[model samples]
Target: MTDALDRIRSIALLLPEVEERVSHGQPTFFVAGKQFAQFRDDHHGDGRVAVCVRTSGMDEQAMLLDAAPDTYSRPAYLGPSGWVAVNVAADDVDWALVEDRVARSWELAAPARLLEAGGR
Candidate 1:
């Protein structure tokens, strides 16, 4: 759990203007005052450790859930808002994909100026 949280912290903090805060008992990442990612460990006793991130929309969320049902799931609270939880506690976890998701979420939450500045 610590490893997953640490990795998420490292990845999320690398983005421009990103900040970390505890929300709902988990570490959440924000950019430009908008939440982008959250590190979840057994959230609500679901017994899953995941990094929840915002997608482009419901279509992307459905696609991800369809593509990798084992690796991805629609999180409880954020699921209705087009957020997908990527399981990072698995032995075969792909850090690159996690980083990509984090970057994409940051882009979604970041302001236009930050996007223009670029580089996560």
Candidate 2:
């Protein structure tokens, strides 16, 4: 569990101008002061450890949730805003998928200049 969290942190921080901070008692990744992703550990006693990130839009969110119920879900509070949660604690954790989600979230929150720089 700790390993997974560490891996998430590493991937999120590697994004351009990303910073990690504690918000609502959870580790949140921000780009240009806007939140993109958050690490939730048993959030609100739900007993699920996952990374919640912003999606391209509601359609993307619905597609992911329908495609992988076990791996993805609509996070509370943020779901209506097109945010999706990826279950990091699943038995078959897909780090590549996680990285992609983080990257997309970063791109969504990043400034135009950062995105124009290729977001490397």
Candidate 3:
């Protein structure tokens, strides 16, 4: 869980104007005051350590869930809103995939002005 959090923090903070805060008892990443991703550690005792991130929409969410059932899941509270919970704690976790998802989530949450500023 600690390693997963460290990896998420490293990727999330590289985006422009991103910040981390404790929201809903988990580490959450935000851009321009809007949430982009959250790090969950056995949230609600569900026995999963994952990173919950917003997708482009339900279509993308469903595609991800269908394509990689082992890596992605519809998170509890955020699922209705097209969010994906990525299993980052797996031993074979792909850091590149996680980085891509984090970047995409940041893009979804970033405002136009911030987006124009570009990410790192």
Candidate 4:
């Protein structure tokens, strides 16, 4: 993987049965029919790629907001219920974290059926 798309694609590779597609005007990767992560470029003109992680509503907002206000933002309009957006700015973000989140997203979205089927 080269950029955010590549990074996300890499993470998707860890799961058994998952698919990638464009949805809601962005590149979205899904597992077992549920969306785990979505990739977004800062703007059509810019080259920065942003990755959004869907967290449990239980996620602590105050700290997340304080730590990296710029890289971390609301998960789109849905930032309210528990989704946090983390910048995967290709050049700066720690890819390992992104990879980990992607892995978790797959686990979160992948249904039990797919998990049991198990295959590359």
Predicted structure with the largest TM-score when compared to the true one: 1
Arranged by lDDT with the best first, the candidates are 1, 3, 2, 4
Model 4 Cα lDDT, one tens digit per residue, 1-120: 245678677777566767788888887777777887777776454454677766655456456767778767776564676666767763677877777766766766777776667633
Q: TM-score for model 1? A: 0.97
Q: How many clashes in each candidate? A: 0, 0, 0, 0
Question: How accurate locally is residue 50 in candidate 3, as Cα lDDT from 0 to 100?
Answer: 96
TM values, all candidates: 0.97, 0.96, 0.97, 0.75
The sequence of per-residue lDDT tens digits that candidate 1 reaches over residues 1-120 is 999999999999988888899998889998878999999999999999999999999999999999999999999999999999999999999999999999999989899998887656
lDDT of 4 at 97: 76
Q: Model 4, 66: alpha-carbon shift in Å?
A: 3.5
Give the worst 10-residue stretch by lDDT in candidate 1. 111-120
Cα miss at 3, model 1 (Å)? 0.6
Name the Cα RMSD for model 1: 0.7
lDDT at residue 100 of model 4 (Cα atoms): 71
Runs of candidate 1 with Cα error greater than 4 angstroms are none
Order of candidate numbers by TM-score, starting with the best: 1, 3, 2, 4
CA deviation > 4 Å runs, candidate 3:
none
Q: Where does candidate 2 have its weakest 10-residue lDDT segment?
A: 111-120
lDDT by residue (tens digit), candidate 3, 1-120: 798899999999988999899999999999989999999999999999999999999999999999999999999999999999999988999999999999999989899987776654
